[model samples]
Target: MAIQKRVGIWIRVSTDMQVKDDSPEHHEQRARYYAQSHDWQVMEVYRLDAVSGKSVMQHPEAQRMLADIRSGHITGLVFSKLARLARSTKELLEFAEIFRQEGADLVSLSENIDTSSPAGRLFFTIISAMAEWEREEIAARVAASVPIRAKLGKSLGGQAPFGYQWSGKEFVVNTTEAPVRALMYQLFLQLQRKKSTAQELNRRGYRTRNGTQFTATTVSRLLRDSTAKGERRANYTQTTGNNKQWVLKPQSEWVIIPCESIISPELWEQCNGILDNQEAKRRPRGPKPVYLLSGFVKCSCGTTMYVYQSSKNYACKRCKTRISVADIDEIYQVYLKEYLSGINREDYLRQSDQQLQEKKQLLEVTVKERTKLAKRITELVDLRLDGSLTKERYTEQYTPLEERMQQLDVIIPELEAEIDVRNIQLISSDVVLTDAKTLYDEWGSMSLDQKRAIVEVITSKVEITKQDITITLAYATPPSSKSREKVSPRHGFMLAISITFAG
Candidate 1:
């Protein structure tokens, strides 16, 4: 007598099948009888109870059966019917190819079909065509319902926008979102009055519907949106092909019912007028002479310091304290030397280098951990094939581990790049310090034009007081003088020196 070939039994019943009382025991009994009649050994029964055949690969026991087939543990597979194996035609054909390449056969007991027989191949092809047609038909029905449902003012499959909540059939105003909408209107008005651009408005903290920080383009879109004006404007174009056009139904064609107004129409118009004026003012003028402290200087009296061109001096509007630009520039240089003296270059470089090395080491460890976890997942898959682990046991153990491994994979690259950045900063600190020193040494020797460039780099602003001079320096960009004087940390990059007359 020829020895019996080892056979693996796969059984699946979708949720609807369970409602109809389809049982795995019935499949197991039939599979057992078929195996016995064929003189085949029943190695193991992999039953995916209450599982859908639509995505057969996701069925726990079905996945185990596939792994076993690939590992050469099972010589043949037996199921109840073609649909029991997979409802998806693509998945069914893929499984058929895998079994064929592995020299394994698939047997459906009720259909009296086996991949080893020519009739079985013809039956499978016919079944696959039917299943694919059914899927396409179901998809078409759902796609056809979308526009009809949307016209009915029903929820059409996406989350409702801010300031609205989904009612049973229509969107209703949400009280909680009302305040946020009001705040957005207020911000838009403020931006307009300040004569600010969209970028400036965003920097002052405007956000989007999703709570994400707003960009210039997003702000512009919101301003032009007719929805905010209590009107629906459409006829918008969505071109799929070059020179192809389709008439788009406007939002006004759907439904226009008033809920609540966040801002008055008068206020909204005023804001729009302000935005238009600001945009006009932002247009480029001819090249203007650069003022050393144009943007940086602030009046001690809490206002912007404006340079008076006729007087050739800087004056605080509120305080009316006038000082020659040249005198302030000289005073700024003296203060820069005092601030540079406080930093110990050798010590700062040593600490920065140590931090860079530590970051690099951490990055290496993270990479190794990610690699180890990935290798372990492959080993777990192999273990399932060798029958050392059941499908349920492998999934329960590997799923969380796989998720953690994916997170580590994303994080490791970010850490490595950060380490590289820190390393560069440490290596270049000395070069930056030397440049600062060179600029300071040449300041007195340079003409007014050259002096202006050096001043622009070293000092941002110079505020003169009755008793002392306060200088604000650029961050990370150091000044030339090397004096070991203690500077207060509060006024970041600031140096305060009492004015003294020559004795």
Candidate 2:
């Protein structure tokens, strides 16, 4: 008796909900039954979820299926339908050619396409074009609804502005953040410099909506948004590269959205009115100050501390509070000795190694998530190319996926860098302690930049007042001391020591 032919079954679905009944799972089961009835061996079952009609090579298992086919491990390939394999006529024909070249038979159970026969090639072209037309018509209907909703003043459907939250129907004032938004506008009008306004907010312990310290550039973008005046604008553009990104286009082309205003017309006018003058004389920003705790230091009065290069100290430009540079180094010596003492010294390597292991595991998870998103993007592109989905449907899904991909692309690298840094810091804890002590011993010989690098890595913040100094270490379990230690060891150290900085 002749040996039975081996075949692989491929199945795909755009969502998990679709797999429940008579779907990819059921279809796979049906395809297997068909293969068995025909006296064929089921070599493999290839499956993918949330995948669109992209190339087989774009998916993980799909690539394996093709490899098995090309290697002659399987002489036949089967699927429930042609739509699962491809959406466009061109792609359907291409898949047929690949199976032919690999000397494998292609069968689609629903459409009765048996590419080993001549008649199957004719139906493949005619039916795919018809399916493509149907998909385009469905997309056209969805795209037609957008302008109608916009004319009716319905929400355009995206994240709401900074000072407002979407209420399902429309945006309403976010009471907590509206006050901050108003104050930002007020401060900008008074200070005339967005950078100064950001500093003022930071001094008062104000942070952006996301809780990170705000920058001068952040302040400018928020104020210029014009949504505070109840006008939401769109069609903003960005430059392709470098520091000059998010550049706005002509004001005439902007589409202003009508919504509830957070600030008065006069306040809005006064703030933006200064833009022309500011731009005319504004010099390109100078290099950022070189200080160990550049963004981390806070003044006793609560504003950020700026570096005074001449005296080699940190001072608040607004309040004139200053801390001598040498004092911070002096305090570091105290921290290191306390931290590296008897019991803590013994536990250093164990503690660091544990933390590094945890961070590395999280990094691996993030990288995997990023890969899945990349595959989804490939599926979307293929769907759009074959007219399987309309431009509007593609955009609705593609835009957010791309945005998330960008965020992950940024975050993944940062996580990897953190893992690298933590490994170095923890694995070499003894060396860090010894090297730090030695650096202080030869402090006079080290350059300012060298000191900044060491200080930046070890310390998180330095808060200086007229009477005392408080330092926070970047360590997991800080060297314990009885100088008003926080109740929870989880909260990083809030160590305070009395030191006088002469005026």
Candidate 3:
């Protein structure tokens, strides 16, 4: 009787591969049948489930079978088809080389190719090219479907953003988290500061929808995002560069759908206005300012004012204008104090409450908007998997959506604060005075950064021309909310001041 050759049967089945009516077990059975017909004994059956045939690096079973072949334990490795072994033509060729070097054989039952035969080796090369071609074709078809799925407003597939949950086929509003959405926009509008909002959120004991604390950066991003305006904007970013991070894509390619607005366009603009100019001037870290308003001061001629010679004077480069830093500082404080004197705490607090209540209502509707955007991402993934979306398209949309959800993860929790009419304690006028002499005494003891922080909170622009020095502040507050927590010993009123000093 002829000695039956010792062989191994290799089988792999991914979800898409199983759609071919070829389960791993069925492939193994077919391989065994083919081995039986060739008078070969199957020593081992190597199986990989839910594994892609892209590469052998991750397949432990396939690697082990290869080792066995190299050790002369098995004479052949048999699978149903060449592509089932590996989708890449280069990888298949490498496998062929490995089998050839090991003095073993690779046999595909369906393709009827045995690597031991000369004609079979030639057929392997041809089949490999065809397998690669099919993969590219499938990829092309998937890529072509991205705009189609996007136009149809389908769910792309990903974890739901805050205030929304996946409902299998699509995203649905998460009833429990709906209120947090409105509060976020309201907080930004009322506070006009991300750091203050973050502090309030942390103090209110509200966690993100994912149960994380809020940060200034996260709050800033959410406030800037137009999605809060009741529309879905998709495909605005794609993963690029070697490290694979999301960056902006063209606006023309964005998939926008109007669902429901969380914050009115007017309120969004108001909040974003403060958030936008917050980073207009970049300050160098660890550098102490020689002049209190160096970068903060701008020349009317559209150039930056710099401190010249003895720190007391600031000169403009383009306009050749100069102003005394001492004069600018004195007048700025006088105007600031004058502005604070008119503020009635109760009036502003009432306005803040009204803004808060209105925003809370708006945030509730944001749940619907979030669900639509979040669901659209999931739909893209489903479309890609089912051959409606290309991998490139799915990746571009899915990655950026995930990053946005991450931003939401940090923002949603911050919507909760301790600022309701009954609970919040506002600074009384007597307890926190905004007098210039009282501030100067505290300023003498503060660090440069602390001084700068106070200036940033108060001063918006210090413009110097030939005749006068005019510093226009956006708004200033005396010991209020989180701002007061950082700027100790001074806090009171919300005031905008314009102070002018003779140059």
Top candidate (TM-score): 1
The 10-residue segment of model 1 with minimum total lDDT is 234-243
Each candidate structure's TM-score, on Cα atoms with residue i matched to residue i, is 0.36, 0.29, 0.31
lDDT of each: 0.62, 0.68, 0.63
Error of 2 at 58 (Å): 11
The Cα RMSD of model 3 versus the native structure comes to: 35.7
lDDT at 203 for candidate 2? Answer: 94
Q: Give the TM-score of candidate 1.
A: 0.36
| Runs of candidate 2 exceeding 4 Å displacement | 1-147, 234-257, 282-503
Order by lDDT, highest first: 2, 3, 1
lDDT of 2 by residue, 87-157 (tens): 65566766666675566788776555554333344444454466556556875685467556655656766
Residue-wise C-alpha lDDT for candidate 3, range 91-164, written one tens digit per residue: 78678766755768787755556654333444555645665576578856865676677677676546555656
* Model 2 global lDDT (CA atoms, 0 to 1): 0.68
